[model samples]
Target: MNKKLKNLVKESYNNGQLDQETVVYIAARLSRKDLKHYISLLKQEEAKHEVLVTSAEKLSSEDVGKIQKLYPGMNVIHSVDKSMINGVRIVENNKEYEINLNRTFHDIIGFLSTHD
Candidate 1:
């Protein structure tokens, strides 16, 4: 994607500052292949701004709110994973933060094995 077009696309989608007329004007200038590449780039950019929070069970609205507060300006998505066995696993900016029974045990086992 062209840097200028990429920036305009991000700005238009993220802030909704660009009007419909402006979007139509921009789209009119791009070729079919360029448009497809732009759409793919847009999807990748969208994913970067999302926060995926998965836990062993559904989180309460209050809990979700707390997580949302932590990641201001970014979209927060919650999911359930019973294998986590409780606690949360937050994935943001391509990094994983896991705090759960499974992680705890793994840590303990690794520690004991290394110390022996």
Candidate 2:
């Protein structure tokens, strides 16, 4: 392509408004003879940016060590709950395991039998 068209493309791409894939897509439309070059560039850029929107919560080294030692074959998917309060509840491999803090709380366990 000519210098003017190349400059416009480079500007739009570097501005980050249009990602590399979109830039290459426009390039392909304009440069039918060199579409293969743009396609390869698009694939490379896409691979590099695929993880941009995919991020997980950070886990500390201690946490990872604990998981490796205790859970063996388990891979923890990071998550949170608003009602988690001060403790954790783990649902692993289709089984529910609840661990709760016993502070400033009331439990009516076996109350019916004792009161009657």
Candidate 3:
């Protein structure tokens, strides 16, 4: 029964209309503890992180290749954001790695402020 419920939830989620109200109603009808457990499993499945590489300009294939080699199995998405100034930023899951001129300038300003 729990397996069937999980499949139903997953199906609804995939179909793109699984709203909070629907989930709340479903949980109200089901055992709260079991529903929570199933939801945790579903979240874990959804937690497959995608790597996003943002830079000031479009990245070359070699740059993307290096990121792929670094992350191995994760999906990589690249986009150009001119605000980065120069260099790249990598975001995976909730963590961000900024290696750019803009970031360096900010760091320097922060250091100067602290020292003053």
Candidate 4:
């Protein structure tokens, strides 16, 4: 979990040369606690960056394409959530971008309440 170890893991993973020998070489250096932490970090590092596009209904090809273009080299996953009513919510890198009917309604209600 130190910077150097994290960088080494990232570099090894990115290099696509993280074979068994490389794993053992790193594993051999760590204590049990560090080994567990290293494994956790490795799993996180190896996970593909994902973009979750949730909407009330399936999006058009054009919309999906636009999102894909926005996030090249990352996975784009789409899911339907009827409660969204309409519009889309995008999740990328732990950040959320939403423009949806539910959000709009909530905002309107909040504004009306504050002014009332």
lDDT of every model, 2 decimals: 0.81, 0.49, 0.78, 0.82
For residues 1-116, what per-residue lDDT tens digits would candidate 4 score against the true structure? Answer: 57866875775553454567778888898899888888877766645477889999988999999999999987899999999899999888768999999889999999999996
Please tell me which model should have the higher lDDT, number 1 or number 2: 1
Q: After superposition, how far is residue 31 of candidate 4 from its true place, in Å?
A: 3.6
- Model 4 earns a TM-score of 0.73
lDDT of 1 by residue, 58-98 (tens): 99899999998999988998889998898899999779988
- In order of listing, the candidates' clash counts read 0, 0, 0, 0
* Local distance difference test, candidate 1: 0.81
TM-score each candidate.
0.69, 0.35, 0.57, 0.73
| lDDT ranking, high to low | 4, 1, 3, 2
lDDT of 2 by residue, 1-116 (tens): 45555454455465444466666557656666556555555454334332211112344668656655656544455455534444555555445565544321434444655686
lDDT of 3 by residue, 36-91 (tens): 87687556545444788899999889989999999887779999989779998888
Lowest lDDT block of 10, candidate 3: 11-20
Q: After superposition, how far is residue 17 of candidate 3 from its true place, in Å?
A: 20
- Lowest lDDT 10-residue stretch of candidate 4: 10-19
Stretches > 4 Å off in candidate 4 = 15-29, 43-48
Q: Positional deviation of 96 in candidate 2, in angstroms?
A: 1.5
Best by lDDT: 4
lDDT of 1 at 7: 78
